[model samples]
Target chain A: MVNRCLITPARTLLTQTINPSLRNGFPAMTEARVLVLDADPLPRLDRLGARARVLHTDEKSLAERLPEADVLLVWDFTSDAVREAWPGPGGRPVWVHTASAGVDRLLFPELLESDAVLTNARGVFDQPIAEYVAGLVLAMAKDFRGSWELQRQHRWQHRETFKVHGSRAVVVGSGPIGRRIGLLLGAMGVRVDLVGRRERTGDPDFGRVHATGALPDLLPEASWVVCAAPLTPETHGMFDARAFALMRPEAHFINIGRGQHVVEDDVVEALQERRIAGAALDVFAQEPLQDSSRLWDAPNLMISPHMSGDTFGWRDDLAEQFLDNFDRWYAGEPLFNVVDKKLGYVPDH
Target chain B: MVNRCLITPARTLLTQTINPSLRNGFPAMTEARVLVLDADPLPRLDRLGARARVLHTDEKSLAERLPEADVLLVWDFTSDAVREAWPGPGGRPVWVHTASAGVDRLLFPELLESDAVLTNARGVFDQPIAEYVAGLVLAMAKDFRGSWELQRQHRWQHRETFKVHGSRAVVVGSGPIGRRIGLLLGAMGVRVDLVGRRERTGDPDFGRVHATGALPDLLPEASWVVCAAPLTPETHGMFDARAFALMRPEAHFINIGRGQHVVEDDVVEALQERRIAGAALDVFAQEPLQDSSRLWDAPNLMISPHMSGDTFGWRDDLAEQFLDNFDRWYAGEPLFNVVDKKLGYVPDH
Candidate 1:
């Protein structure tokens, strides 16, 4: 026999946040108080605010308030508070959502084993990140840094630059973001090889996604080695000294994925030794990278704060996504973008 | 008369230069004396060496030798010697070719009115320029300078960025490069309006290419205004104060075409006044832009020494293109990429 579930009137924010275009489900649903761990002001959640109580907090106050909130909105995905505080319960929330695609920080054993459902802002960042990656490819191939340096010195030096067309790129990931990247690169006449965790076929974006086993063979042939994979036990430190040694000397590396997906020390060493042509990293193992990090001194490396996928209206997109999911949950429907807790990411299929 | 024209064995370079893929048309054609005005070493013409007497000259000695040449190859595309020396009483060659897309420097009245047919390296630079312009757009939107500056200081600062998708763009030349830029930008989801000299329809890349007359209406709505028009009597200084004024204050301007297309003083003024957000210029009114130029200090302005379309091995591509056209000329066939003398550019059709 199936049991009927009911939330108190105070938790309706969960119901209202779902796509408003979706039929209102479970009328008179409880209005749960939402604890928002914010780094900065999020896009105003007018519809959700009208339906539920949202208590804004920060990394400092997140732990103290975790027990009182009925729901947790990890708006400040960069914080580790959720992992640190989840075990301390007044029981954890029934569901947890992060305004980020990577959930490495929220994958602690306790939460992974918990009954809580996890969701992330996925679709919103995919296209933007793909666009960013495309830009990175062109920027590197065109020697934009050299151009910028010349401009700085008021120098007018004309030099030969490499072209982006007909080049080979191996994108490491088979998720929507990775596929979108491949699609955009392919649109520009680049031959793209997409690598995923397992062998796959029949993908429209990547006709036949290669498995991780193919990486060794693929690396040497790629002029562009892009890391867009999630940070999991298998992926963490995958791009190490050995991986760098496998790449062609002229190949460039770009990371729009988790920093842990690459070994920081190894990347630095390779860059310093010129093991690879260059690297453009938008994510780092330790963000707001330590002021003394030697990676800054590595020749031909470009470091960007983790804003590869955050475009002008990104916050709004994140908020809207959450609302849509909330609506589905309110209607007693399964949530979209649900993460496979054991795998540490949402399975593409 | 279908009579075979004989070329003296000494001038074989002129006939041998044609693409051998042309079935060795008009066998034993006239070996015409070929004059190359070069600032740098011209590509070694191995095949042509046996068929033509190649004469290499620099700007200093160009006039002295122009009268005796049967054909002219302006390998020093940047020099004005061709235009300045064309009027000297010595007869001009039947055909002249410049290793560049822009022929402004060679558009003197004497050459245009003469029987000389002109050709240029058109297709080679199209894709490269398109890629460069796309890079510039991303660079400006991503605030690459700020990121570079922060990287220099080993400081990590994350800031919000505008999205490329959904933003509107106005690309001011509907030539191959401009259309390719529009195509790539469109692939990234940006709405682009391509402007040409006249209204055109049914372009596979851009459904409708707007005419210059649409600028007044389109500029104000554009967030990115790109100038890729060639320099001509009708185009010189076209982007003046009035053009800048018509654009949105948040707009960014990119000039990958001839620098003379924009009025330097007006651009600097607009940048200083924050009339437009920023600009990236790969070309200038005077190249090797005078180090003392005030534009160096203009806020939100990026400058490069006119190398947008040149990629590695570009010299080879130019040589090959020239040789292909020469083959057609050798066979008395119509040449490709013939610039309309009256219009100062190759007509799109």
Candidate 2:
């Protein structure tokens, strides 16, 4: 997800209530009703001011509001509330857009069958998530957590760490985010094998993009196995006990993708039994994982909340991207980052 | 250190005693006596067997053995025994080499004035240290420490972290190590300003290597300030309070160079005052940095036991490197990493 760092007047005008139609390029989107599924510290959609009748709703009110809206903005991408409160296929908005890259949460049977077009905030998160993955890889390889622990004890113990250079990594996602991760890791001297939905050759970035089925063969050879795949039926629970068994004892595992992509119990068991070197999870099966969960006690495991793609000023970037797409929608132009409801992600073309 | 992952026969023959002279391309040098300043688990110099009389000595026995040895291999590079036991200009080994990058420990006035040639393991540590520094930069930018802390408390907290890409780094030290660091960071999309003792232009890696005098101007703009400079009178205590004060509040300071380059107390004060965002020190003025040292409690300060360049198999690499240089010394070929004693480093060619 590589968002253009747009330098637009809306960045400054976000907090203000201004008639956006007077702006140079934006035409009024009159007669359209926009329904926002709200979260705390609501998004600055003032950029769409006086152009459409914007309505805000929570999980409780979303179903009733769905029938009247012309456009549905899933601002609270974390919620599965939309799925639970979704109106029937016939009453839904004409267009549905999620403020996130993954459309997994929104892919209910009704929504998938609905005529409403699906789009997502895809490009905004690519680079940030890639940087985060690289950081995790380095942290695990260098034993930074061990260093911090040693520092806490005021002990100066020297340990020989693993080198990131010349190491092999299998990145299980050939999307923009995974591609960026491969590029950054490659920059650090890592040999990256990117895995896509299907086998592809002569990729501009990765010379050979292996298919998902090739993971079993690739797992044993990699020093790192990263999960960045979209959460589709075929991808869900792809990294289970068998997958962990195939990995070398020295290899590390990292997941910045949807939690469903990994079997949490198997990873926890792998760490406890020392089957793998270590693991870093930025996403879990249940985000804000319950405090009583066994994951907190998993040995040699690093757990970070699902904030990999959210860097400082990320909200501003997301907002800008949404507005840009909104402008295209208003002009009767085809939108960017349209997710294929059946596929659960924008097909890599 | 960037030790070559050598696949020589010696790697397997290391533990066994063998007459190395029978090996291809190696000539016997029975006249030379080599003294190894030893540490626990002595280096496998079996490759030197029967060629030179090898003697292992510790700090107490070093001065007594100095007169008998023709060559001094400072295997225990951390020890200051050489400086304390040096027999002065009248009686000294013809050549001295440290199995480490910095020659600060061996740069005593007597040795500098003597005819003995000093060489260091220069190329070995360059790539490893660069990788370590890059790791530290990514770790700090992504707030890995904070994530670890939250994970420890079973807290699922999401925080926006800084992006490493598009950040500026001021790397002080235009040597191989610094150059490599700049290259790796540049690969991560960071703009690097490499500062050297003297200004240089059109450097094959870094186009314009700024002089040390430009540091103050560069400091305020950098998100990271890295010290990889060799320790010399001119560079000693260079990163003091003034340097920290000049840095942006968001900037992180990293020291992979000699501890003397930084005034420890000044850094302690800066960290305590929250003048800088964070810091990571792999070297301290007095290491195994005393248990009572205030650095341990310094907020956001990451401390390690001077192991930045020490990756797994580093010792073997160092041993092999020393033996490689030994081959040149025995052949009477000019040494590869001959240090300019007056400058206290291998001058950049």
Candidate 3:
């Protein structure tokens, strides 16, 4: 059954009235009132003013206005309002979408139990993350960091570096991001072992797609080990002392996955002891890692502040995806990218 | 008919009398007296004892010893012995293989006219060069350089980066090295445009292949422009002022090819003007690039001492390749990776 709900059109009316001066060829959205909970105001909403009412609010004001909205667009991922206000009086907004993957911050007991639809920005990050992983693999293999340091000192020391082709790699995660990483490395004649929840036949040239249980055997043979897995009960702290111990002393470890999946202290120890060659870490268990953290002093380590998938024009892509999803919903078609309450994706697992 | 040559039993007797240690497994001209003219000794050849006598000589000794050797293995790439002495020899060796790629130093008129076969260490570098190109592409796109700087300053700034997938790239050169680079990037979902010497049918991924003439059109559209072309009359200084101007302002240029292909001053001007985003250079017109060079101060530039295709087991692989070629030669079978004298490869073309 399709959920139909009425929305108060004040915000939509205000947005429509303000749009013409801002954008050229602005499109009108005339179906429902859309409440945007974003830290910064979106100027593109002016284009959708005629068909839809757009209201802007922060976390504090969201709960009071929850009942009147027909849809909730979570643009401010840092806010927890979506979780707190989702179980409001008029049976929650018919649909809710976050402009980010991993809806951990927006999940609440009440929202999880509701019939409201949830979707995420999944496809947008696949390529960027894959590219990041490839870069790290190359950087470590070529010793770009060492070369850069040498250049600064005006040193002309020529040293040999490792090669990516004909090397073995293990990409841990079967989602879009991990699959893309595997595909990129595989194209380069690298033997890639992809680890997923379960083996699937449709995957591309993956040497062996094993379950998480096979990681112990796979780690020792890999020349480059990458963690692109999600942060879940089974995945958290998965790359601990034991995993690092299993890897070849010359192997490089990279993490585009959540920080908790790797124990930071264990990684520090491994790098200090040269158990593993080096690592490129984008995410951390804590955001804005404290300046005093010992990871800064670890040899051969690269730290990026959790920005692997972000790219120019990303927001525009997210908005376009949602608009396309909205059109599909209005036409009585099954919504694409529906998040299953249990699996946190569409078609309910 | 294929050229046929034979080694007499007397010559083999001379090798056995001078050096018996080379009889076991020394691959390169085991039954020949060899001369190494480099300042540093070839430690790699230490195992090739009695059957192959290695004489470390200066210009004077090299001039005196030129008449007796069965082969000349040029480990000192900077020396001009082959160019000066080949014509003066009583019985010059039948073969000469340089440890370096460019034959300009040894390609004297006398050697060119002689029956002496010449080869370069070509296969050993193909994968490593490809890997280096991949690293530069990833590093530029991910802003890895900027992130490293931020880390040094103890700042955690999250910035956006571009994805490699669905992005367009142009790899100039169709040799084993360039082809491998294309394959690696293609695996990452990038639509790679490969520019070769000339366009042909029945080639791998024929649809994406382009000729050198297409550079003007291809440059602007390429998000990442990789220069892997060999140094030739046409390729020398190919990526100069006009080439830099044609690129998209956001595009990144990487040179794994000869440094002569790029005009250093023009590159500096382009970088200074921000007409092109950045570049990573592993080669230069003058290596051990002058310490006073202005390129050091150029914004968004990465420099390395031309060690892209070098790795730890590289010499071992070269030895293995030579042995395989030796087996083919001894068995009167067609040799693999034969260099065409005119095209600098065995007439596979």
Q: Could you say which candidate leads in TM-score?
A: 2
Name the better of 1 and 2 by DockQ. 2
Residue range A204-283, candidate 1, lDDT tens digits: 76789999999999999999999998888999899999999999999999999998888988998998888999999999
**Which lDDT tens digits does candidate 3 get at residues B1-349?**
1222232333333334345564444345554566666545343664454445666666656766766665566666656666666645346665565665555566566776765666666667777887788788888888888888888888999887887778888899877778778877776677888998777556755365688999999999998899887676678899888999999999989998888889999999999999999988888888779999888778889999888887877766655555444444333344444344555432324
Question: Model 3 TM-score?
Answer: 0.85
- Per-residue C-alpha lDDT of model 2 across residues B1-349, encoded as one tens digit per residue: 3222212222112111233453344445244678899986688888876767899899999999998776789998899999889985546777787999999999899898886777788888777888889889989988989988988899998999988889999999988899899999999999999999999898888889999999879999999999999999999999999999999889899999999999999998998888999999999899889999988998889999999999888899888988887776665455677888888888765
TM-score of each: 0.92, 0.92, 0.85
lDDT of 2 at A18: 29
Residue runs of model 3 more than 4 Å from their true location after superposition: A1-30, A41-50, A86-91, A198-208, A345-349, B1-30, B36-60, B78-81, B85-89, B197-202, B207-213, B327-348
TM-score between candidate 2 chain A and the true chain A = 0.91
In candidate 3, how many Å is residue B90 off? 3.5
Q: How close is chain B to the truth by TM-score, in each candidate? A: 0.91, 0.91, 0.83
DockQ of candidate model 1: 0.65
The candidate maximizing DockQ is 2
Candidate 3 chain B has its poorest 10 consecutive residues by lDDT at B1-10
> DockQ of every model listed?
0.65, 0.74, 0.68
DockQ leaderboard ranking: 2, 3, 1
Compute the TM-score of each model's chain A versus the native chain A and list the values. 0.90, 0.91, 0.85
